[model samples]
Target: MNDITPADSAERRRRVARAIQRRMVAHVAAGGTTDFASGPLENDPAAYTDPARAELERREIFLKVPLVAGLSRAVPRPGDSLLFEEFGQSIVIVRGRDGVLRAFLNMCTHRGTKLVRAGADGTCERRGRMTCPFHAWTFELDGSLVGVPGRQGFEGIDMSRRNLIQVPVAEWNGIVFVRAAAGSDELDIPAYLGAFAPELAQLELADAAPIRSSSLAADCNWKCALDTYGEGYHFATLHASTIGVSHYGNVAVFDDFGPHWRINFPDRRVKALVGLPESEWPEADYGGVHFLFPNTVVVVGSGGPGGAFVRMFRIFPGQTPGTMSCRIEVYALRGVRADGDRAGEFAQDDAESDVTREDYRVAVDGYANLVSAPAGFTVVYGRNELALQSLHRHIARAIGVPL
Candidate 1:
């Protein structure tokens, strides 16, 4: 898929509007029957509890797959860099002076020391150089080792071969993705996105900028944390005090875009769109929750005090099998009051924290009970939870596990 032009972008918006209209009409006619999968699905408990299975997933799913590392705005300028760990691999994403975004293993060439230890993300003002703190070994943003201290001590060493190891990196619609494993230069991000590419492109994420970001360490398996956003079945019960007032209960429209899925939840105000034409329909009428295969969820909702905003939840495997880390970034549309504004950004974070904290609490409790349950314990996915089933099935296929 190609980047959406202005005409294509407007047409895509209309397409989404019409699709939402059709779903709303069908929903009203059906008296609130939710979209469903072929049948209920069961997941093996070992997928979440077994260390051996976790290791397999780390290889096949996390390392082999193209994982979203950060947003384009994270390194918007040529000298900016972001560092983070994914599945035990520390990665550095830097923008070169030539305006190219590249990713490398965040290790020193001399003694395997980390090149950037300031924090998760920072800006490099040395123009084209990344200096290792240990020995002051310098490298260009393109991963070329340009300066090495005590060069005479290593007479036969080839600086070209000692440059930082370059990993597979690609950017699609302002989202940066990297393959952490070595020799993974052939991963095609667009092909990995499949049918979901166009829809993501329609969001015009490249034009939107991040206003605020935060990370949380959760006490649950990575899949468990991801499962929280795959379904709306718990909205009324789990989020009753938070977001339940605005959304309907257990009602959603589901679409499978290849291995990924999109779930649209009609809020209480959706009924107002019954008589409006597609052109008059607003995109904010429906809450769009998209699962970008493997480990990301993009939620589009009202911007609370401003306009609409997109919240991206990038989930990663923690140090242990039963833990996970999540980085949430909030991006506002252009010309919105919240765009690049600190106070508006704080409001977005506060709103997200309210709902997310509730979800994480439930996940932690559920994981505890799941692991302690009797042998052969399994988790059942209701037909309404089709996205959740799709996620597990994709992971199973990737790791050579049976359904």
Candidate 2:
């Protein structure tokens, strides 16, 4: 395979540079709400690289935020339930018989054992109770410890008064959220979602069930993994072999919403977006990318609504100073009408998923090299780095660390 010459890179890089300049200038000229010059957490270096500092954040910031422990997706039916771990706490998300979404700590009150193991499907034996396998401790779907294996073991044990710990949880825009600490106050999920709420509310994501799910552990910083996504700046070179012609938009249009951020761009291959002049670019059919506070990133469009043809979610973690685990969720719009009949939704979804996996492989390799350096320094983030900066600042503010 022929490598891209310096001249080819220069030409494409120049185009991307000019696009970013224009977008930034226009955003400021229009009096956009974000202040990119100096954000609240712009200079906090400890939050990103310090393990001890990150631990404090893991306790107060991540646990109480309501963003980390929420229900990401759910089915409205009563039997539907989901489980995930967040901020070192195991969370159980279930829909009660009244079809209310409830979240509880997945722990058995006896011996302080974790009731459910990881990767197990959700189940509730009673209308509101889930059974513990270790000691056969049965808990209500709502977390009430209604049954114990032996009544004779404890003469005065009050099962009625001994219920499984319930955590504060709220579901909004089809995603469920939880607060791990006991006696923690409820969070306004809608407000916490900030600007992304409008678009999310329109998605109706709960109507869709996860058809397939996969996770991968990588030896790289969580932010490093997430930063590799969003911008198309590296596409032409990094993905030259497989995805050279499918999409376009090497430019990134970054918009900040307090701690949340959104990045939008037009795929050059999409005739709906590419045919128009750069200034008149259609925002309606163009692709959109959104980051939910800290760890969730979704790419939509180039396919249709919910990107009927495309949808990908990235869940990454700060496993260590330099290692991260990322889980990618890919879903294709099933039984949805498309504006165009050019490609099948499932085929397009699979193709997009492949591209993402390829990107992950390359990024992890790059991260390994960076962390191995003897004298570590800051990595330079150019105009394409706005989304990352936005995320970093948000994390700093949330942690109450100086930015």
Candidate 3:
């Protein structure tokens, strides 16, 4: 073996030391009780929804933060890939023979061709290899440019020099996340996950099959759509038809872990959570909302020692100023079923039709009015908007965009 340089040895030792220190801190923290507090988000016009300002903010958060790109699983095994678009970049994620997940920009190197024409639903084709219909430039699942039709015309062209551009990607929590930034290594996914990584690991999302998946586009600024989901205060008024069973404004708890925050809506189980007076309250109602930074929201319903169910929200920004898209997924413990489907599964089916329809109608109406408001902008975020503020602040800091 080559001699190890002293600097390299020192660097290795430092990394090991940090890992040990992190574990020790985690052990001590785990031994103690935990508390969650809500953080404040200011109404910053420059960051929230301004077309010019939002563009700069989005670039930093989506392109600079090596967040979701490092922790989501593309494919759990070999020969699998997922194609999607985000942040004005077409992305293709694939699992190589080594079982490593990799991401690439979907643009073809030659003549600026789009390597993968999106399928009907605007997702990956999922076939073995992707073929560009424009000139039939074929790329393997690993993103190597394998063939160029009619190669005789371009003699001495180095095929190896023409491989597809690769994007940064990492896998954690059974989800695949891609970052459009170039020259970025695998992000420290677990650290960005903060206190929730361990809790998330227990879910075994890689094994959890998605019963259904749907995407919705709303005529609202992306932040507006995200804001709508961050708080439960709207449940009583906005979601009255669907979430009426759940009481709001009764008891709430908030917790922050630097960039991450969790806003817990008092579940009916605890006496304090009982909405009515102690005399009229019953036991056994429970739920909470866990908001992750950079646009991933998970709502959890209390089960017992473990979680009962969770609904996932993945928000994507549209190229236009006032357009946004969202993906919703619901998962539950294995073998748990309700009305022939998994307990949380039914809610997911209704997400697009009922839940999303309600949210969409409100979002479109809300943004249209905000943009058209005579006074220009008058926005209100009640105390229940605490988590929304927290999210905004985290996003602001990550993107260097103030709001």
Candidate 4:
């Protein structure tokens, strides 16, 4: 792991990009990881197969820590919201008329049925208020109860106390995060982000717009499926026919800010930068996958410089340790989406989908084995798989477990 501290500056990005390019070009020449000394760690198979441990992670990590809801740009205007139904609970992350983002338990104040039904894309369309599908109870974007049907029938019902219950919500850079449990002061995202804050800002996510979105369901542990996104070692065997053809396999650059990281499997085209002067190197294709701690991946698409894009992957644990779901949201800078020259329009929808399918196919099959693997077998992360190692390590520390 070339654990360069993640920096917030454009110069740092430029420098880091060039350095990674140079390093990757050399690795392409050497055909293996040689710069870092970190190594293969065996993790207990029980971690992925144990319901007891999965429940612990659910309580400590998923519910306690702030989880990614969606992009801020998805709800850029007042009264916009999306249903974030994960962990068997429904919640709505909404924006108010006063331009503040708030989250509410999706239950109606009257009968406890879901008040908002999201469209096929997980977004809700409302001018400023949402009425319950069951009782026609109305709520403002800020979750204040405004109107009630049959008010006289239900006499002495205090509307003030019937407001929608609120949970904590925060917007950092362009990412919107929510804590399932109710709390106000604890969701300091910037503080939680720590050194990763500046690196996230460089993506300019707040100014971007959502283009497309999709979801994946897999029969594997959530962390097992998530590990697929943290390393490039599998490209040679697993993605050989896809990403392997265009990008070098088993080679990458790693940088970290606490548990968060930026790991890139460089473009083979970067080999052109090997002997050339650094000043003459083009800055158009310097990109990497940024891993937000716990469960989110922001792939800063390197489809040339001006036409920037990002793909976000948010994974959620299922009821059992052997099942999980993932949400994939694609976004691009506002103007770039409208530009005629936007890059990889087909690649985003087709090629990336193919790659994700390949990843989960293996994860599900491997998980099947782990489920029955002798209560003692282990999963190994190779010497070069630094990001995966750090990820599991952080999860263990967070849940008070020994990895």
Among these predictions, the greatest lDDT belongs to 4
Q: Candidate 3 on 1-403: residue-level lDDT in tens?
A: 1134435543553453334333323333344111223443346443445787567657877676654422233255565566656455767777777777777887787786676664675435456777887888888878888888998877888878888888878776565666677657767767677686644454444545444456778878777778766665666677676654444322345556666666555322233422344345333323346666777776655333333556677776777668888876655643245543554356444642575677778877877766756543546555556666677767667666555
Which has the higher lDDT value, candidate number 1 or candidate number 3? 1
lDDT of each prediction vs. the true structure? Answer: 0.79, 0.59, 0.60, 0.80
At residue 268, give the lDDT of candidate 1: 72
Native-structure RMSD, model 2: 9.8
Backbone Cα, N, C clashes tallied per candidate: 0, 13, 12, 0
Query: TM-score of the candidate numbered 1?
Result: 0.92
For every candidate structure, what is the RMSD over all alpha carbons to the true structure, in angstroms? 2.5, 9.8, 9.4, 3.7
What ranking of all candidate models by lDDT puts the best one first? 4, 1, 3, 2
The digit string of per-residue lDDT tens for model 2 on 1-403 reads 1144435533543454456445644543344322243422233333445677557666756676765432244445674666666345677777777767677677778777777654433332333457777888887666777788887897787767678777777776556667767667876877787666655554444443444556677666676677767566676677775455554435546766777776765334334433346577433342357677767776655454344433545454555665666555544433345435334555666676677777778767766666454453555554555777777666666666755
Q: Write the per-residue lDDT of candidate 4 for residues 40-157, one digit (tens) a residue.
A: 8889988888999998998888888788898787787888887789754688888888888888899898989999887875677866788898889999888889888889977887
* TM-scores for every predicted model: 0.92, 0.77, 0.76, 0.92
Q: Which runs of model 2 end up more than 4 angstroms from their true locations?
A: 1-49, 68-73, 117-128, 242-244, 270-283, 302-314, 332-343, 370-376, 400-403
- Per-residue lDDT, model 2, residue 127, is 38
- Per-residue C-alpha lDDT of model 1 across residues 80-134, encoded as one tens digit per residue: 8877574567888888888888888999999998897534433334345889989
How well does candidate 3 match the true structure in TM-score terms?
0.76
In model 1, residue pairs whose N, Cα or C atoms come closer than 3 Å (at least 3 residues apart or on different chains), thus clashing, are: none
- The local distance difference test score of model 3 is 0.60
Q: CA shift at 376, candidate 1, in angstroms? A: 3.1
